[model samples]
Target: MRIAILGATSQIAKDLILSFAAHSQHDLVLYARRPEVVSQWMNNIGLVDRYLVADFTAFSPAEHFDALLNFVGVGNPAQAAEMGASIFDVTLKYDDMALGYLHQHPDCRYIFLSSGAAYGASFDEPVNETTQASIAINNLQPQDWYGVAKLHAECRHRALAPLPIVDLRVFNYFSHTQDMEARFLITDIVRAIRDKTALKTSSDYIVRDYLHPADFYQLVRVLLAAPATNTALDCYSLAPIDKATLLTVMQDKFGLLYEIQHSGVAVNATGRKPNYFSKNKYPKEFGYYPSFSSINGICNEIEKYFMQDNLY
Candidate 1:
């Protein structure tokens, strides 16, 4: 299979490029905004045949691709600013290429990296592919701009479904490919622990599941190898998000302490477990139950990166 990957620079994207390039007998081509901005060895894990570069603002998919791993959405934080100017193109422009690429190569097996945001507000119950979308069309005015962008990307994938498209509304994923600049809580915690800083979290922590990079990659490989398998499980979580009360557990376990500011309101995220993701199919599909999820996998990265002298 000849594969083209857009936005091969994200932690998730970087991992996908490497994993696919390594295992599959496919000819791989990687693309990013700046040709060499991405680390040389990042996408070469599988030794892709080509590494093309182009700004998504000027994105145009190159021809002759058998499959596409479109993981191009950057969770820009500006969309929620009080006077935000909507620099959404820096993000939405990739949707242009993903849709166009699928249209151009009708036979291409396209995998659009959708998000758990598509579940919208139906989080009242366990979310499935059939759950009603929480947000209405174009009403993407959320503080978590990344979540909004993910919602938009999923919609685009839906528009191109007849073209062998596999849409995955993945939830929180943590791994080593993460950029130092990223503000994800797990990475932030790792950095704080490495540097020994106080972690200030909400009095009632937000409960979200986490997954290890390897497990996440395994799921991606299963989907890419079997693109026709529409088994769309709406969400993926490494740990049972139900126990997500506070990272104070993580903090205390790691010998770190912090302050918490609770909402002091009823029925809010004031130290409560939000939901749990159903994880049967993921195991059935990938043959690997995510053992090292958020509670463990995230800390694992810190252990690997920092525990050089038996610090754990």
Candidate 2:
């Protein structure tokens, strides 16, 4: 298959690119704002001259691609907050670009990298197929912009029902390629372990499902092979993990030291999510079942990270 990957520099996109190159015979054309960086990264990974790398500006409708995956958006909460209202523009711009190509090539399947944030701020429980998006339209916060942007894109895709597009609402994702300095709980734990310092965190009883790269790659492959459909699918693992369990596992496995502060840590830039995963089993219909649970996936990736850096 000829696949076009936008925002190819993203961590998830890079992981998928590696997986595709190593595991499949797909011809991948990478589109990024910084094409040189993508090329350099490919070189660093010993993937030199294996795929075509082009700038987003170079994307043309005339190009032939069986699948186009849009990973073009803010990668982290900090980036989302920093991007502000521009998040909507960034999402719309690339989505419109993809839509234009879809209009010309209806056979091409589009897989958008959406977020669990699209389900909105009320995640008291896991989201399911019946769950509706909740938004405070009258009182919009900076935290709400990213999710709203993604939801807006999904709405547009649904409206174009005839087009073959699928939005994957990813709740949590982690890999060895993740930015260690990023302000995520897992990244914080990684940093602490690497530096051999105590991690200060809030005692928020949050639940998350971290989808491993391998499972995510399998999901994408399944989607690409499935019949054309215009709908969204929630990404999930075999099981989700809670804050206490995650900390305990870290301590037991990696000698992690941590303290819970009564004052609590600052809220994430994308707002708080107590139950940030989904209960939707829709992906099973497409023959994609995760092989790793949240804790196990986290441990697997962290071990890879340590091995890569010789820190373990």
Best by TM-score, which number?
2
Worst ten in a row by lDDT for model 2: 262-271
Error of 2 at 38 (Å): 0.3
lDDT of 1 by residue, 187-226 (tens): 5566566567775554543456676667777766666656
TM-score of each: 0.76, 0.99
lDDT of 1 at 308: 52
Clashes of 2: 0
Deviation (Å) of 278 in candidate 2: 0.4
Kindly report which residue stretches of model 1 are placed more than 4 angstroms away from their true locations once superposed. 21-25, 39-62, 76-92, 122-126, 136-149, 227-232, 242-249, 263-273, 276-291, 307-312
